[model samples]
Target: MSDLRQAARAAGTGGNGARRRPAFIITIDVEEDDAWSGSATVATRNAAFLPRFQALCDRYGLPPTYLVDWTMATSPAFQEFGRAVLERGRGEIGMHLHAWTTPPILPLTGADHRHKPFLTDYPEHVMAAKVTTATRVLEDTFQIAPVSHRAGRWMLDETYARILVEHGYLADCSVTPHISWRGTSGAPGGRGPKDYTGFPEKPYFVDPEALHRAGGSPLLEVPMTIAVRRYGAVVERARALLSRSGPARRASGRLWPATTWMRPNGRNRRDMIELARRALHSGRDHVEFMLHSSELMPGGSPYFRTFRSVEALYDDIEALFAFASGPFEGLTLSGYRARFAADAGRPPESAAGPRRTG
Candidate 1:
């Protein structure tokens, strides 16, 4: 705990007297429609709806980072829209790897994602190949080496973070704070997915392994904003500690953690607003909101099943933007990483964004 506190202070999360407005970042997973189905036959009709969502972000000057997957990268519809957005400087493009759908598919000892549904289930080399291939496709499609990422199926781990560092990615938005995909099948016979319980809400360089701990890696982790209401800070710290104790974890089921995400899907605007308020009060440096592109089109995602529900999501998004427009500065994922660097008294990565040198 002490080591993490020191690492965080050095990373510029806090300890300095200077105060900065918390940043807000929206990261949308741009993948094929009905992605949950894990169908090999790719479809991305949902790409047609990005401009509509971008228009809404434009209304609030919030440029989102569209995390493009292999399917979206190849979709002519998405290429057209993504090109226009980049040309107009309306948004940024980053990588989102869906292991089952991404190329260089290797047969694993266990079930494929259709049955197992975990990217960490595959070997590191397999994921490495998928990531390398995906990066090339995105660069060819958008003409910029993506510096940001969010792993598919929330399967971020030591291996995934190391892969990002190897590829020159500047930041990853895959860690869901206080959440654990533990006990889920992973790496065939290896350990389950990483547990992000007690992960920092603020961006920080991760450790060599155990991403939950602060380490010296340059690949910054921008954890998705998940908030708890009562005893917010205490609960967060305690949850982290409890994550390791078997007895405590068993007791936690009855303790009511009451976690909430800033996402618009299946949530209300007021709760989002309150979470933002609490985050600000806690001196958090950023708030991240994530949603899937499939949620934009009617009947594309299960969370948003109808046109009316999708519209309601838009309304919720508009209200969040309306609230955030005043107090927080909005940035794309890579854009915010640059800002965080500068705020920490380091040089900005670049006007466009940073590329990995190592």
Candidate 2:
């Protein structure tokens, strides 16, 4: 704990003289209707959960950031939601593109699921077109130009960084390290079984050569933290195993179980807690956490096929906010960007982006 205090001091957020504000960035990837399932097409299913999220934020006097997909924005509900977010003055409306959900590849097949060429191999022109269109739509409809982003499915490559730069997106929150996404078509690479020692758990600028590296990209990768025991396994396995009886067993396996991936060997909730603790103790002040907005909705929705109920999502949201708030001061992405700009000797953070186009 003493070392952590020292680290905080060195990072410019230490001592009563320095006045450190712990920063928590919560980024939600909003792509409710773009999933592989046909039934999940209604935008309202995802929109319905927004009010509760808003209520939660209001109660906490915090602004929640919403990254809206262009396709989802076309719906009336989303348009109103976007306006509401802007009106609240607490949220940021940013782009969340699901290239796989548009045009030729949309209405996806099992094959599309197996091979996500829309994201990984699309021509630069095609990719740019998708991003531009979404950017325009959000700007036009909501009257807000989105400056932050998260790629749908976390499926991206170097091409994405170039695309974001072209589209005027300065910060990206993709790239989950210390985990593998094999067989989950279009997912990025992570540590292999033979090597697991390297990878960053916090945010940093995206390095161009990340694609070729064992862990992958540098795009300000704000990966979710994972906690593990001394034996290199997540600590929650015992509870998960114990809950494996009767309806609980069926529920755990089907309804958003804390599994890392489709593979039997996976990360657990404790993994995240451990990482969060380490970051706090190590003097690191920023902890960026994310989850799909679709998962916050009710069960049986196409967006959250794993069928975790709305209540379950609330539990996750409340717990995460409580844990992070208790340890770190929370900041919206915009707030964090401002701090970065200040550090860079540039204009004030709010003065750092392109003008709104609507």
Candidate 3:
């Protein structure tokens, strides 16, 4: 916590021009339309809804990095769409691993089978294999190696970070600040992942062993943009602190399940816009926005059940995108990583080649 505090305070001093142009990055988790069901079987039906969503991104010139899982990797339609986006230089296809679906499937007890196990629970060897296999699938499907990632459940650990770097990834956006998965539903035995309560609100080169601190690893952990309108800095910091405590987090969730996060949930467009505004005004270099592709199709997600609601979400995103795209330059996740490196006077984060175009 003290280190994160120090890092948060040390934000602007690191780079010369890093503060000159703040960026807004968009990422979508492309996966099966299971609607949070932890089942291993994948239907990939919801991918049909992505074309329209991509159209919206095109209109606003907001390039998105589609964080694909194994299911989306195998979908022919998604593959064609991803290739087209990549060829056009308008989007990136990156990996997103759902531990349960990306095989070498592990043997799990009945309880574990029912509950989605975070990669934090996987044996280091199994994690290595799953990640390698998933990465290979994306490479084969897209003919390009992916360099950006987000764990399926926001469940990241040092082991996962190490695996990502070994496989040539440059940035991972899995940490959600002012929130924690502690005591949340997870692996077979008991409670959830370690608390991310103290990670800095901005991107930092992660210490390979301890994810929360700044270090020399090439894999920069771009923490998700999470801020709520109603909660000020002090109040939100308190929420993050309390989230670290077992009884407090449980009670708070029970009493107010929806009190946290400014991720684009479409519940209120103004709230997200204001938070983005605040980030820009504060001179932060990058703001990363994320959403799951499953949420686009009606009935594919619990929060959005009707076509009307989905359309409303589209409208809200348009308004927010219009506002964000104007002042803040839009960058893909990897592109923003390059910006960070350049700001630090380091070489561009290496990719397989300049993204190939026909």
Candidate 4:
């Protein structure tokens, strides 16, 4: 184990010196089926899997945080389902911004042509407008103001974080630690944040100007759990080397043993479980798991193109839940934040300056 892992493990004890049980937040990026295509038209998306996804959550007694985007937020059927989830006290609704479809579509001018649906890439004014429109749509449709957000494409930055604070959002789950999407084909034209190479895997309060570093800012950054095992340093070096080229970076992400970002679908179950076990052993209090809602239905996502594939995904999720139930208490994003705040004896709000409108 690396020094950081060793230190984290040693620190994973309660105030009384006993090992603290791990907790987890299962977040779903609830959006349109065409999200990956970058051609997502508002009218072309369907949230057909929401009901089934909610049923799975109900079955496992897990309260998931649905980070909905403009498409899902505006769908009456989706809203009805969300209402039921809220009524049953089974889930929390949060914002997931897909800048392209979020409205007030900024004109493609100058660097705007490089737009990648990542809110952070836009001008501050454009970003603010898009965020405002999306948040308002979600509030108006759901009749509840959301306090948590997840940026589309995992492309959040300091500006986005500050905007989130201004909008009264208290938690963000957009950071994927130890990974940087820059130069990858996934982030077209190589315009994405290049700095997450050394971010802490555990949750921490964000410092707007230096998001990777922990500080006293009120906005809680609950990053998705990504753990690199025995060859962590070696993997980091290789990723850094490959990141210089777009094709190389994309290939590196597909390379196994280079690293693992916990996801429930497909071949990730074993890595997810193994990473969770490591986090538990290291004294980390929580693991944030995420997947796209479209992945829940056949023909919705590439990962689940068939009915059998979809069923297999569910089986994998259930198996992970079974393994984690005893070692980790599952909570929604907001629930985890509240618990973390209470444990730290701090108020739920940010301790930094007043929330400013962007």
What are the per-model numbers of colliding residue pairs?
3, 8, 0, 3
Best by TM-score: 3
lDDT score of residue 106 within candidate 1: 74
Supply the global lDDT for candidate 1.
Answer: 0.78
Q: What is the TM-score (0 to 1) of candidate 4?
A: 0.84
Model 2: pairs clashing at backbone N, Cα or C within 3 Å? 22-329, 206-218, 206-219, 225-272, 226-271, 226-272, 227-271, 227-272
User: Which ten residues in a row are the worst by lDDT in model 2?
Assistant: 259-268
Which of the two, 2 or 3, has more TM-score? Answer: 3
- Per-candidate alpha-carbon RMSD to the true structure: 6.9, 7.0, 6.4, 4.9
Candidate 2: misplaced stretches above 4 Å? 1-11, 14-17, 33-44, 103-118, 186-199, 209-221, 226-229, 232-275, 300-308, 344-358
Predicted candidate 2 versus true structure: per-residue lDDT over 132-184, tens digit per residue? 77788887898766777777766657677767755667566655555454434
Q: In order, what lDDT does every prediction score?
A: 0.78, 0.58, 0.77, 0.75
lDDT of 3: 0.77
| RMSD over all Cα atoms, model 2 | 7.0
Q: List the candidates' TM-scores in order.
A: 0.82, 0.72, 0.85, 0.84
Alpha carbon lDDT of residue 267, candidate 3? Answer: 71
lDDT by residue (tens digit), candidate 3, 131-232: 888888888878887989999788888888888888888889999987777756777663358688778888888888898999888888898888633646
**Which stretches of candidate 3 lie above 4 Å from their native place?**
1-20, 38-40, 111-113, 228-262, 348-358
Winner on lDDT between 3 and 4 is: 3
Worst window of 10 by summed lDDT in candidate 1? 3-12
